[model samples]
Target: MKRIAVVGGGISGVTAAWQLARERAAGRAVEWVLYEAGARLGGTVETERRSGFVMECGPDSWVTEKPWARELAAELGLEDEVVASNDAIRRTYLLWGGRLVALPGAMRMMVPVDLEAIADSPLFSEDARRAYMQEPERAAELKATALPEGRDESVASFVRRHFGDEVTRTVAAPLLAGVFGGDVETLSVRAVMEPFVRLEQQYGSLILALRERATKVKGPKKSVFTTLKSGLGTFVEAMQREIPPQMVRLREPVEAIARIGGRWQLKSSRGAEEFDAVFVATPAHVTRRLLEPLDAEAAELVKLEASSAVVAALAFDAERARGMEIPEGFGYLVPPQTAGEDSLLACTFVNQKFGHRAPEGGVLLRAFFGNRAAGTLMAASDEEVISRAREQMALALGELPQPTHALVRRWPFSLPQYAVGHLDRMRALEERVARLPGLRLLGNAYYGVGLPGLMHEARKAAEEALG
Candidate 1:
């Protein structure tokens, strides 16, 4: 029999262990152990349920375009739980000048597929509108100036190259920050926004590419996001149930990892253990430390800056929620510069975004604190965090009623920032990792930060390690 070790019981690590479990049950002649430092699993993916309300503590849902998470849900016998977002009223608002303004319809991020929508929208100034209108004509120029085959640039530069400063600041920055929790000025265009980069290389103008894409891609439009009816926490629970309970070692942190005699050795609270293969799915910082003794150069390559986040989910009863006039759209994002000292990053109208989140007539609102704000607020009491979120949200959506149920969560250094040239660094890191036999690295620290990406990476790493 072969022994395998999986460190850090986040979604990625858990998924890897689950894959191994499946193989073991099918007579693969393998045994595995999952080590988690925390008391619970799921890392940032968690859900809270109370008073007929299902509030997501971390990620509410995965983007529908990525099938990995949805597929995994199906494999876990959660097929009926899969639900799509309510795209009929899928409008996202922006907090500008202390007022909520709806972004133009038929717009993908900063690029507007419907030029007429941009012209009629109040979100962008006349200068920004002109930039959108002129982008098609400048397609040839953009193509000529596109970065060479193997070069990378900041997301800010890529957005400015096409839509100029106003669009980058007013629209792009907030959208990116809401997802990646980092400054557009430092995030890599090639790594974080690869699809858009490819469009730039091919069509030069993102607007042109999106317009053509709209016409060519023929299908009943899918929802932008998808989730299980019970909540993402159910996904974690289902995965845990499938894997043998004895194989999971909760609260046992991996102190260090080393490559010895072409095998992997992991030292944890239970002392040292040897394995035929090891999968490290911890956060970037932790993984860097574990890799330091094995290969200092690889450690240097994995040293990427990460950002923190804070979430507050407030669930109001039917009567109290009805009294508050919430907007129809999904949620709103606060531009960093416009936010000033305020820590609010974004808020989600949970019921409107997806069904089954709140009971009939009830409401659930989730507030996200930005990276800088999260650092200062992480140490505060849950009441303080909830109060601050409620106060900030009330400013945009009028006086909010006292919530019937509320919860707060803090994730420090969770989102790793993929800086410019991140792809190049990851390429070198992959090469170094390959040199260490029976070792694999998996997590949000490389490739992507989305649920689907992590699932895909974890499954592939598990298969490779087994082979």
Candidate 2:
């Protein structure tokens, strides 16, 4: 029998192990063990249910365009549980000058497909609006100046080149911050914003590319995001059922891994074990530590900086919700310039964003603190976190009634910042890993951060390992 070891039990590790289990069931003569340092398997992908609210403690949903997560959900017999974000009234607000300003409709990130929508918007000043109008005319110039293939730049430079400084600061900063918990000045344009980069390469002007694509594509659009009806917790639960309980080693932290002759050796709390193949799926920092002794160059490649996040979820009952005024949009984002210590990086009006998240009359609000703010609050008590979140939300939206239930979750160094030239670094890392036989690295740290991308990578890693 072929023995394989999966270290760390985040979504990526779980997915890899689940695939191995399927291979075993199909008579592949394989046996595998999943080692998770934490007692729970899901890592940050957790959900809490109380008083009819399906509250997500971490990531709420996956982008719908990526089909890997949806495919996995279907395979797990959760097709019916899959739900789409409510896009009909889909609106996202930006906190500007102590007011909520709706992002213009028909936008792909900082690029606007409908120029008329932003022409008079308060979010952009007269000069910024003019920059939007002049982009298409400057398409030829932009195309001429587009970086050659394989070269990289920061997201700030890319957005500023097309939209000018004001739009990049006002619109792109908070928007990208909400998604990546990263600063545009440091994040890789080629790594994190690949689609926009491709658009730049092909059409020069992103606005033109989006506009032309909109005309060519003919179909009803899928919702921007997708999730399970009950909560993402259900997805994790279903995945756990596929793997035997005995095969999962919870609370068994892998101390180190070494190459032993033709096989791999994992030293954990239960002592050392040899495996035919091994998947290192821990966080970037942990993975770096484990690999340093075995392959220093590979370890250096995995040494990416990461950001933390804090989530405070407040659920208000129907009666209390009725007395408060909530906006119709999904939620709002706070730019760094306008944010203070107690300010939120972003907030999601859970009930409005998706159905089945809250009971008919109840309201579910989630406040997020990202990057440095999250680092500062990592040691804070739950009460301190909740109080600050509530105070910030009340300041942004309005006076809020007391919540029926509230909870706080802290994820330290969860989001890995894809620095400029990240792809080049990852390529070198992959080459170094390939030199070591029967080894694969799978996680958000290598490729993409979203669930769908991780799912695809995990499945592929399992196939390659067994093959």
Candidate 3:
């Protein structure tokens, strides 16, 4: 039997192992093992509940548009447990001009799907709204324009060009920051927002393309996000259930995978072991260390990537929170210009988002801080992070009583920033690794950071490896 080793126990690593197991169960001649430096199986996907309040250490849910996550749930017998978001009260707020401005009812990642609604909405000035109305024609005119050769631009540049500076600063920046935890000015457009780029390239304008796509849809609208009733941790547990016992080694740190005797050898604290194949799903920074000994140049590219974040969850009595009169909304994102240097990135009304987040009469609030500026916030003491969160909440909502309890989860070097021309960089790294047979790269840093993207990439890597 061929023995394969999977490095990192996060969603991607676990999913890769699961796919390989499926191959083995089908009578394939292969055996696989998973290694994790940490004791936990979920990586950052942690959910803790106490006193009827649930706290998500990592992501709360996965978007249903990405089918890999949903399909995995059914494969694990968790489809029934997958609960959709409470659509009855769906709302999101954008913090602009020192106020929690409700986002237009129909908006997609700062794109105003409904121009008339946006024109009437207070999120943009009249002049800005007028500029937006003219974007389709302007973008059509600019369609003949081509991207500069061998280089990628930033999200800030794309948003400013298609929309305007006002939209970039006031709306897109904050919402994007919540996802990347890095500066949009440096993040890559091709890597981060490729779909938008494709829309522009294919139809000559994103606005027109969106309008055309909307007219062609034939089914009733479905919820975009879903999570297990017990929380996303349940999904992790479900996946873990499929993995064989003794195959997963918790707290076993893998130091490197180097070519030895035409086979890959894993060097770790537990000593060296050989495997027919290997998969890397850890953070890019850690991936760098492991790859350095094999290909110094390729490892350097991984070293260039970095990510970090902090999530603070505050629990409060529902009646007391209601007294503060915080408006009804899903959550709010703080624009960088308005948020200043020391503020948070975003806040989620966890209790309002999903009914099961809190007990029948309690409230749970989540404050997210990401990237370098927010990385400093992550490095701060837990009490200090919570204190900052409290101050931010006070500014957003009226003053309220102290939280009954709080939990702070730190994810160091967690979210990867796809820097300008990141796809090119990734391609170069893939070429280098391809020379090493049976070795594959799979992680959130490359294709996407969402749960579904990770699973999708994991499945692809496993299929390729097993074949």
Candidate 4:
């Protein structure tokens, strides 16, 4: 049997192994082993249950438009376990000038395609509204001219150019920052949000793209974003159920990986293993260290840069939360420009967004901190982090009630920021990897940082390795 080893037991690693196993079960005659540095299989993707509260350490749900994650869930017989968000409450908040304001309903992320929505929304100032109105007229001239080649611009630059500084700094920047957990000024608009940028290039107007998209009817619009009824951990548990117990080795960290005599050798603190093929699914930095001896240039590219973040889950009585006057929306995101005043980047109203996340009379709030310039915040003590979160919560939610429960989760080098020239860099890296036989790299850094993106990359890597 052909032996294959999958390193890093994260979503990407597990998915890759599972796909390979599926192919093997179809008479490929392949043997597989998965190694995880941590004791648990899911990396960053974790759900904790405490006092009837289901706290998600990483992502709360997956986007349906991506398709890969949802498809995988269905294939695993977990369709019944999936639950969608309350569409009636599909609202997000933005922090502007020390106030939590609802993002305009029709405003999709960085694109303010809905003029009437922006005008009617309370989120922007009169000046901001006037400035945003000029975008369509300004963009018209660019549409008439020849498009630039390899247009590489930051989210801040692109937003400010089309929609004014207020829109960029207050709304666009915060939304992107919350999603990427990185600085908007360094984030590549084309790389991070290609669909929106492409829509603007192709249709000349974001409003037009949205209108066209609205007409397309596919599947139940009800479950756009979904999670397991039990918790996100249910998905992880389901994946584990499909794999043999002996194939997965937890708490086994690989220190080095090198090619020896036409095969791959992986050295871990626990021991060493040999395999015909290998899949690297850890973070870029970790991958860099593991592959340093084998490929110096590949390791260097992997060490470019990544952002760190911390999530604080605070639980309080529902009565106290109601007394604090917290609004009905899911949560609010703070732009990087409002750095000092609002140390928090975003806050998720856990209880309101998902059912059974908190006790019947309890409220759960998850606050995210640290971006590019503020990554040092992740190193702070739990008490200090909680205090900072409370300070921001008080300003956004109006009042701060002492929490009955608080959990601090820190991620060092959590989200990788795809800056200018990122695609070119990835292309070069892919070409280099193609030269190495029976080896593949898969993770959030390549395609996207979302769950669906990771699964897509994993499945693609598995196909390449098996082929």
C-alpha lDDT of candidate 3 relative to the true structure: 0.82
The TM-score values for the models, in the order shown, are 0.99, 0.99, 0.95, 0.93
lDDT of 1 by residue, 1-467 (tens): 88999999999999999999988888888999999999999999888889789989888899899999989998999999999999999999998778899999898888899899998988788999899999999999998888787999999999998988999999999999988888999999999888898998899999999989999988799888999999999988999998999999999999999787877889998899999988899999999999999999999999999999999999998988777888898999999878866558999999999999999999999999967779878999999998999899988998888899999999999999999999999999999998988789999999999998898899888777667
Per-residue C-alpha lDDT of model 3 across residues 366-462, encoded as one tens digit per residue: 9888755466886688899888888887788757578877899999888888889888988888899878788888887777889998988988888
Rank by lDDT (best first) = 2, 1, 3, 4
lDDT of 2 by residue, 355-451 (tens): 9998889999999999777987899999899888888898778988888999999998899999999999999998999898888898889789999
Task: Tell me the lDDT of model 1 at 359.
Answer: 93
- Compute the lDDT of residue 391 as modeled in candidate 2: 86
Clashes by residue pair, model 1: none
Q: Give one digit per residue, the lDDT tens place, for model 4 in 1-467.
A: 88988999988998888888788778787888898989998888888888788889888898766778778889999888777777668788877778877888765675655688888887778998887776566657645541355767887787776667887877877887787776778888778878877776776656566667767856656645777767877777888877887999899888888898999998888778899999999998888887688888877777657888788888886666566666786888876776674378889987778777887878999998766424666667889878878887888776688887788888888889998778778888888787778888878777678988888888887777667
Give the per-residue Cα lDDT of candidate 1 at 186: 97
Q: What are the clash counts of all predictions, listed in order?
A: 0, 0, 2, 0
* Candidate 2: segments with Cα more than 4 A from true spot: none
State in Å the error of residue 225, model 2: 0.5
Candidate 1 ranges with C-alpha deviation above 4 Å: none
Runs off by more than 4 Å, candidate 4: 122-127, 145-149, 215-224, 317-322, 372-377
